[model samples]
Target chain A: MLIRRPPDLLPSEITPEPLARGRRALLKGLGAGAALAGLGLPQISQAGSLGTLRPSPLSSDEKLTPLKSVTGYNNFYEFGTDKEDPARHAPGRLKTQPWTVTVEGEIKRPRTFSIDDLLKLAPLEERIYRMRCVEGWSMVIPWVGFPLAELIRQVEPNGQARFVEFVTLADPQQMPGVRSPLLDWPYVEGLRLDEAQHPLTLLAVGLYGEVLPAQNGAPIRLVVPWKYGFKSAKSIVRIRFVREQPRSTWMKAGPSEYGFYSNVNPAVDHPRWSQATERRIGEFIKRKTLPFNGYADQVAGLYSGMDLRRFF
Target chain B: MTFQPTPRQLTAIKAALFLLTLLPALHYAHGLWSDSLGANPIEALTRGMGIWTLNFLFLTLCVSPLRKLSGWHWLLRLRRMLGLTAFAYGCLHLLTYLWLDQFWDVDAIARDIWKRPFITVGATAFLLMLPLALTSSHAAIRSLGGKRWQSLHRAVYAVAILGVVHYLWLVKRVALLDPIIYALVLAILLGWRVVERIRLNGPWPTRSTPPAVQPVVFMKRDAAAALGVPKKR
Candidate 1:
């Protein structure tokens, strides 16, 4: 698969050759180690590194957020509610290898694909996308994954499949926060069929050219660049195609604050806080939040005539 | 068991408490210097100061209940200092938001105070604390007269309630455990005062003069006089 770098990206902005080569070597070592440790065993292993990543034209040319910040700060409520809780607790708790994603409901071909199968389905492209949180913060993340459309096409949704729902793992033994009644367990998120099939929508397995850390939804996760970060569900174990709009976890938690569309529109303020501006993760001063998180040219047509304030 | 701290012991205790209260500020400062306050140091600093402000407010409210329960009049000697410390931290919290977070952008600050409910409640709570802090000095208390001063200072309860509400309103509903805990603590403190009021008098207000207010004792009588706190009648 031939991949083209983003036109705006400078040669200097690409990952250094030595670092990329070293990471590739580390990934090879990890694969060997996993094989030696009894390939037949079902026990999950730790995430190490992802091999060579092809730069995609879809990538944002903006400066990448620091890997430390991306890995350290997270909103994975299954681990805990605090931003730092996921990093503190998920490493030792979550088991990621031998993972399988069950694709079912309203699809022509429903099948459970193991993590290895999913990784080999398509070439992993490094797409740097701007991620905006509903809580007035944002990050630029280089996610390594293929378009969700690739997997969707493989499954071939039936006529009845109007929406797709993503469900995350919620084992109490693995996720301590699952014990707390924060939201209904087995966190669920959904997207309209077209939105899910968007070329920008990704099924990310790694970030920053490395296999995702446990805190960052190891094995696989969704990355919907146009929506608020929560709309991109993490540590997904199931994807179900549905006939009707599925109620997401956040919608159930706060219906007024978190709407189904959840497209990043600065005009639609959250009931509690303004969506006008966002503090970029590392920056001190807040910057004006863009409509559709600056993907207006690509996604504005999706919500052309709808009232975002009402939908939001 | 009955225990009463001596005058010298009271001064030492006050001195120790003063130093202890500064620790949270120092910790945030050191975190900033070392670049260890996670991804957003500005947020950590702003939030750390705000939480410490609430802590001091809780500590200030604890004095009355602790004094009444233990029959230790000396605890009142520390109340003014504790209240003042809460005000100090409140100032730092607001400054951090205005300077670091907002970068002294008057339009943005105004927009936040006007548009955001959490900011509205937080700013109102700080505004209400100002008069109480100003009247905290013995001279101002004397000028306002004890009876009127006490009534005015009672606004602290409102400030405490607003502060907790501000916290509750700002956080996402899923992460409300911390704010709810603060609300519960304030409820118990205020409830204790309510139960004490009914026990002392009756449930209803009476035409007759209520019992004498608690004596405003100080660490040293001469020092108290210098500070304008009247001697116990």
Candidate 2:
């Protein structure tokens, strides 16, 4: 789909001729010290004293430890079986500074918005979310971003828009993980009409305070915290509002293991394991997966009256 | 290429080889209990155990080839145990995916096996390993008789190939090194068998050759139940 780029920003990060990508903009506007310091919180907690005596501030409600930290720190298994693979390998390759998301499919304005345009459209807010993976593990990330609905409204959805399909960048040349055959590259994810419209869903651009690390889907990505991590498709390149149910990458790969809803519920057990419990990242010693990833009040209503066992 | 292997030495070697196959799975379980499994430990554990199971399957397939080509008859005794151990690790690999990855989500798991090619192949390999494991016991072997038992265990060859295909396709990219090594090992094992088949001309002959009209030993359907493998497809 053709996309109308915002008044500012280039179409792609890479240019034949030498030109600055977001380095100057990010450093000058955001402040390198502030950005680095913001990213340092996790590292400090990860490296510093991790024992029963000293728990992470992130785990205000739960007993936290290093095993719990593991769930949060290293999660992208598609990149490598190692937990730290995504973080260690993702940063430089994912050029986020010059990123723009192409919004198309059943929209009043089939346009592309620059990172700056997104920030100007709506102010950023931090939501402490508990992210549960389909693999029975969980993590709480204090994500800073804007509501997904706000962006959807800006595009002006057409009447036919019944679902939102999110596509991740699939550049094996840039993303080493894409080079692996673990999954179909450029991981795809989607949400139903109502679910996409839900207030809890976020079109996250940053974490801590700075723009999201490239490893964390830099620039912008979907964040359905209460659902499995796969629901939060990283490095979003396309945002399509479709009439039919979009085929999700993981669901298509293994439909039995991944459902359309993918809500975080202990009742539904993946054939190989029980979803009844989850090891909360950072709260390794004291982590216990809660209903709706401990955000029951915010998201439990969405799945009301539905049988999780069947959907799961 | 043929050499002599005694029944007594074969029995002992088979028992030891079986124990060796359990090491990887036992290591994984120990890691899980010791909290040594890395973050997202299940993936590593699952992948490790799965690859090991496939490795053992290839190793088991090589026994006859090694015996014939290397002229080491002792290899034959290790075949059954090696095959059984492969099945054991295969079971653990499947369990890890079910309990750790899918969380007992039967519908999701079933859908994955049906929809995903890798999962389908993996689940099939595991299922194929089950009959091999069940029939590894001496009692089942005795009941099935030698010829029938050998024929039943031949499923290991298919299971090994399927296991490799499952691993190869699971990667988003080819993951060139690991899968290639596995393929190479499997190729060498199978290749040796091909050579042995050519050398022997056909199935190996025993000390006793039947007279002009020897009574053929056929496995009765009821008795076939005792063998490890399902009656030939």
- Maximum-TM-score candidate: 1
DockQ winner: 1
Candidate 2 docking class = incorrect
Candidate 1 local lDDT, A1-312, one digit each (tens): 112455676786665566456444654567643453234222224444455467877788676677778989899999988899999999978888678999999999999999888888887778999999988899999898889999999999999999999999999999999998979989999999999999999999888766778898987899999899999999999999999999999999989889999999898888887788889998877999999999999988887798888887
Error of 2 at B58 (Å): 2.4
Estimate, for each residue in B19-103, the C-alpha lDDT of model 1 and write its tens digit: 9988998998899899999998888888888888898999999999999889987889998888888899999999999998778
What CAPRI-style quality would you assign to candidate 1? medium
Task: Write candidate 2's Cα lDDT for B1-233 as tens digits.
Answer: 46554677666766676676666767887987886766656666888888888877877777776676587766666676777777777888888888876678788688778766778888876776677787788887788777777666666666777788888776533244578788788877766666555455544354254211111122222124333345433
Cα lDDT tens digits for candidate 2, A1-312: 011123454344222121123222333454434444444331111212101111112222222223224223654544554566677777666676666788999999999987667766665555546677776566645455677888888888989999999987887677766666657766888898678877788877655434566666766778886788878988788889999998898777778778888877777666555576676542333245577776687667777897877876
Model 1 CA deviation exceeding 4 Å by range: A1-12, A15-46, B205-233
Give the fraction of native contacts in model 2. Answer: 0.09
lDDT of 1: 0.83
Best-performing candidate as measured by lDDT? 1
